[model samples]
Target chain A: MSDLPKILHVEDDPDIREIALMALEVVGGLDVVQCASGAEALERAPGIAPDLLLLDVMMPGMSGDETLTALRKVPQFSETPAIFMTAKAQHSEVDRLKELGALDVITKPFDPMTLADQIISIWQER
Target chain B: MSQGSESYLVSLLGPATAGAVVSLAILLMIGLLARSALGHRRQLRKIREQEDDLALQRKAVDMHAMVKITGVDGRILYANDNLIQTIGYSVEELRGRYASDVFLDEDPRIAAEMWETLRRGDAWTGDNKLRRRHGTAIWVKTTAIPKMGRNGTLDKVITVYTDITDAKLRQQEGPLRAMFDRLQDEVYIFSVDDLRLHYLNKRARASLGWERLNYRSHFLSETTSTFDEARFRERVAPLLAGEVEAVIYESSLSGRPVEINLQLDESVVGEPRFVAVVRDISQRKQVEQARAAFVATVTHELRAPMTSIKGAMKLVASGATGPIPDKPAQMIDLALRNVDRLLLLINDLLDLEKLDNAQTEIRRDPVNLAELIDDAIAHNMGYAQEYGVTFTALPAMPSTLQIVGDRDRLMQVLTNLMSNAAKFSEVGGVVEVGLEDRGDEARITVTDHGIGIPEEAQSRLFERFVQAETAEHKKRKGTGLGLSIVKSIVERHGGRVDFFSIPGEGTTFVIDLPKASDEMSRAA
Candidate 1:
């Protein structure tokens, strides 16, 4: 409830991270918290309790699917809205993402300027 | 009357004495003539004896005992009918011919020694292979003797040759025995009728730990513990009747496992024989057992985690726990992509495992190489377009270059290479694809003008999960298993891949493959 929407951005790449941050904060006019790895995202989720979460599809150590599995174990994140940023945007791939409880898939090399707006529209529709 | 008779007797006696003188003169002349006639008759008889001796000598020279007579000069003075026939020459042709000409071999020292002995009125005897008039070699035993004068001087040499081709053939058996002794594989020749060993090679003897004569010492039952003599005979009698191509028996001899492959020797008539090759396969059996166990263990371990993870992902994605909100939705999306990546990784790992287990099966068919290239290009064109990279194929490339392969797999290989090219290329950079039709093969090449891979990285580029280690490579990301999988698929299709690249310039990957035929046509 702060009138501003809260968003979580989980990405392994630094460039992708900075771009996603600027897109949410300045362009989409939302409050954003960024994490470098899937483990960090899981750790910060309980404290931050963001309204929407944006995640990169691939990372070392723990994968996004595994991290999401861990997140679903927490009560507060049981029905949170989520989207994935990935380089693969084939229809079969998107269908699989949908099967994993994702609202939509945002293909990577995303126009960082309009990323947060795209997420907001998706969220408001839900 | 007595005085008149006495006077007449004296007159008669004087006349008789004159008459006796005349008779004596005449008798002496006749005796002289008779002596001359007797001497002439004796001379004529000597001439007739000489003529008879010459006729006998000529007849002896014509006889079939392989014979050759030489003079002091070692030149052939006489060659018999048999020697001429065996040496394929006429007596007239051989006479005055050097005796060495008929000898298959003339060792210089032996020839010289022969002449030296014959010069001292001695004889020589030896067996040799003499060259026939037609240049065929014939084995012969020859004897040369020098005929001496009353003064002990060498007059002539008499040589006779006895054909010994059979003995020469027997001499050839020695090398064959030596060859059989040197054989590494077990070889046994048994009389078909008696079912007894006629010949056994050294390897066969050593394996059975028996001598040549002991080959028939033991029956099949002694070596084959699995079956007794009656049963063994029953199983093999049909094979000897030409009912089967071979008889395979795995048995243990002296507690050591042996694999025996018995094949009938059909070379001889009126009798059937067998050739058995025995090999020890105990070690191979042990290794196979160990490998089977390993596969079973690994499959069990991998299946559990995979089932749980996949089932959970499916359930969550299906929204089993009601609807998803905005924040968790993003997390789920990433999870799903990673899951897909994991699935692909698992599939690749399983393929590698199958390769390790020697269970990889390649399904080959006729594929159009040029068409496969098009399909691969089409598959990656969308991704390439996103990067603003133009993939241009040269016009020289044919529309359909045919070769034998697994179609889908080959497409996967080409798509992987193209994917790598598209991912690594800079925005607006040109990627050129080329194809060439060699006689029985086709060559495909992809050239990219983006940041080229380093030589060191190129070496390990086709290794699993190995990515380029350059700054530009980091910008364009991938799973890094593309090249490795591509290489495996290409190699499985019986092809090879090689690439050339200069760091900061460009890279080119070339694939060479055999041409494939159409499925229907191939089956036909």
Candidate 2:
């Protein structure tokens, strides 16, 4: 929508949160807003209206699947390009996430420097 | 008197010489004959007195001594008053009776054997029970001596006997027999030669469901109908031959398999006897089987999730797609670490279950204790440096102190302890490792100057999934099963662990293992 592609990042771990923010914002140079938990992303994603949402698969309170289900309830997010960031990227799990309306999956321990570039390329392909 | 008498005889003879001389000669002859007759009569009277004394002595012996005369065929030929009275038989009734007729039915062979002994010219002397004429049995100790002719041929047997019926009957019901029949356990006496059952207790009869006392004569298969005859005979053969002391077997009774534990009685030497105890263990076997199934289910279920998480992480790290960016890669790293922690937790649980199930078999061999310690220390040193802690091993330790052990498992145990030390220690703290040589054991101790576990936590530290106090420890990440795994692995190796800790000060963990001698080490 804007000159910078809007990206939504959800995470529960503080260290991973800080590292993810730096890699996507400073290194990859992408417009990004961070949510510390799946619950926070559900609450704020509707308001921020991002073009893409990048979600961590595991969180204690609300898992990525649950957050995604909540996001799909919003009318504007129905066709928004979304990707899952998870530790579990098995073939079956990846296929299951795609069926749940996710465009793609990015495994955790991701390279921080190229995270935003990956998001753009996925968005272009979509 | 002789000179005066001679002078007077001479004067009288001159007066009437012829008539006086004839009278004197006749008188002298009569006197001589009278004296000789008196001496013969005195000898005859003395011989008569000696005859009376000999008859009295013969009468006394005949009446006082017990006498029995048996023919060469062991038939009673003659008996004295004492023998007839003791056996409750008249002489007319005792005569021509076979010696075996009076013996008890249970011991008929004894009577036949005793008769054979007498017929062989050897006298039999022993106590035996004989049935009286009134059908009441009396025990008598008899000594029979054979009467022999000048040619050394046996003519008859002269037996002298004493009645011991009352004494022998008293001993028959003595405390020994009472004690034997009163035992609570099933007991039996079996003969080695014929395997004849000689004795059986009330419990043994009840266990076998037998009502007859002569069940002892019945074979084991006959008593236990369900028992496999050949198998039972084979199993008991060893016990009978004195090769095996006891035998244990599981057999079915009323469709339920029962455990039978048979033990030989060692005190009754030369005669074989066995005592068997039957116990029902069907419930225990069922419980064990169920436990094994549960362990298998848990292992399969737990391993599934762990495999998924670990495999996916490995794929992501290898970059099948475009390379991952720094921030996303860091998030992935966080997930990977948590997955690793979960995997460790599962591994620890599975390890404990394996140990509990006795499925964790160790291939034991002679392992150099020094090398084991060195490898463990080397593996942990990098982590120790990362935590800014110093690790030190005491010098002059035996480099070749070998022990019979599973090398890999022992290394794992030592590494776990050292890693725990480094993880719990403050930065720049020191950890010490040392070994002491005991006569039959080696004691390895690991000391760390760390924020030692609190007393309350120390007790639970070796329990599965148990963490220490929440304060100052919440930052550390772990599955909280390291110490438990260490304890289990150590115990499996026939070793034990002990530790002492002071909160906020330091902690020390000691491993005590029996030292393997050089000979044993070489053999292993």
Candidate 3:
């Protein structure tokens, strides 16, 4: 793990992606490569070789967990650490996501200012 | 003793000889008269003793059972006090009325069967559903015996019955029988000895395509797609042996998926029966799948845009992008508050729906009471500050006190309570939270110095959409679902929540949760 890890962020909504770009790159001072969907992330995974995966669940092409399952087939991203952001509030759902080998689950309507720090803390813990 | 008969005797014979013969005749007559008096005295004594015995037997029978005697022509000759009281009819009203008319609910089928049994001279002993004077119906375990006259003529019929209404309720067709008849699930009761169904609710009959009024001849095997008497008996072996209370089976019945839960009813000694409730789950499965899809869509679709909207407003409000003017900042703060409020309402509504639908599974684990309290206080501190109120924890004894509950749900309960206290408290008032360790239970209290709830509002305070109408409470503008959620969460964990409120003074909410048993704690 690096002091500030390079990240691959996938979200369907462009506004959410823009907010994350500002929060991570400008505010938290980290290099973040953004993709609009799981398919785009899969296409770019070989080139990015990111240290961490930031995925948004409930996306268009494939869910965040489903995408993680797919990317694990590639040796480059097989051992990559991932964290999921979800709007689903059920504890059981959260537990299910955790069982899929994610670092942690962050609930939606999150504090934008603290998003970068939350990722960094989880990354360090991993 | 007539003198004329004595004088005739004297004239017929000589005086001395007549006198001697008359004396002998008088002695014979007096001796016969004395013997007749003795016989009368003995008969009187026997009659009094017999009357006493019959009265005692009548009193004993009338105390416990209802008796009715009908003439050979079917007219009621007598109805005892117990029968009159139980049927709610006067003696005059019942006399001369046909027993079937008063007791058989006007069902010709049952009446015909009963009369046939009596005419055949076979005693009819079974459960009879009879209507009372007020049209309220009850079940009586009846036994009818016919008295035979000389030359095989029918003299009369004496019927005795005991009210088995409570016992019959296990079949789900008693006092609420009309409602039971309207149920969606099929209910069947069969004797354990012979697996022959004696009763079927209306739904059961309709679904089984059996429009015939009698279900007594139908066996449990007939209702299933795979009819095997031995296999059916084997399946309910546990319930029959009393090893388990019920047998829950999921199988296809006539190509329809059904859940059959059968329990043994041993209320009638020597006549154990099985009460089976069958529900068609094919329709339920489709409905459940659709409901699950809708809930997921609503949860995802509603939260997605709201997440973006809140994030943007929060970023701007924080001045993370750039410096903002004071008025726009205030406006943004207001928008942010309402956004949070809307989110809270959505979360509360989802939780309520989950609880109502029995979708929320409460996980039981050992939770430290003091630690949970500390966490709740920390979580609600920001909200308390918004109300200019402070939350203080009154230290709990045996801070290591433990309870059996779901940690997340317990946290939710405490957070709701603490936040509610903060919201309703007077500005700068201190809301006290405490936990006490009783022997087998833990007592939790959250007290607030606020505008106390009125007496009338307290009764329905935990109901959905009910909030105190006080100006202070109104200004706080809560979703009014917090306490209800709190109560629901606590109750789901097998705990109780109550409050004592004095208007214009303050309110204190106390929760009592059972402590985790030693075995439970160790096992967990």
In terms of DockQ, the best-performing candidate is 3
How good is the docking of model 2, by CAPRI class?
incorrect
Task: Write candidate 2's Cα lDDT for B1-524 as tens digits.
Answer: 25576567777766477457667887999999999999999999999999999988756745765577887777889877866775677887778986566532225576567667766778778775556665456666778787776777777888776666546634753565467567654565554445566556666677667756567447655655576756767778767677667777777766765677777754421233566666666776687677756765565455444544554554455453358878887888888877777766766666666667543456468987877777778878787887888778888777767678777677777877887788889998888888877766788899998888878787777887788765766666467777877788778777899999998888999998878877777778
Top lDDT: which candidate number?
3
Candidate 3's docking class is medium
- The lowest-lDDT stretch of 10 consecutive residues in candidate 2 chain B is B265-274
* Model 1 spans with C-alpha error above 4 angstroms: A1-126, B1-321, B385-392, B475-479, B516-524
Q: Judge candidate 3 at residue B273 and give its lDDT.
A: 75
- What lDDT would each prediction earn against the true structure? 0.70, 0.72, 0.84
Q: Which ten residues in a row have the lowest lDDT in candidate 1 chain B?
A: B299-308
lDDT of 2 at B154: 71
Which one is best on TM-score? 3
Question: Stretches of candidate 3 above 4 Å error?
Answer: B1-184, B188-274, B281-288, B388-390, B393-403, B436-442, B514-524
What would the per-residue lDDT of candidate 3 be over residues B1-524, giving only the tens digit for each residue? 56887788779886788889888988999999999999999999999999999999989988989999999888999999988987788899889998667755446787678778887788888887777775556788888898878868778999898888757765654555577688899888887777888778899999888877577777877876687777788888878688788898777888888889999876543356788899999977677667666777877787787878888888888887899999999999999989998998988887776665444568878999898888888888897888899988996456889987899888888888887888777889999999998787899999998888878789999999899787766887689888889988888887899999998788999999989988788867
DockQ of 3: 0.50
Rank order (by lDDT, best first): 3, 2, 1
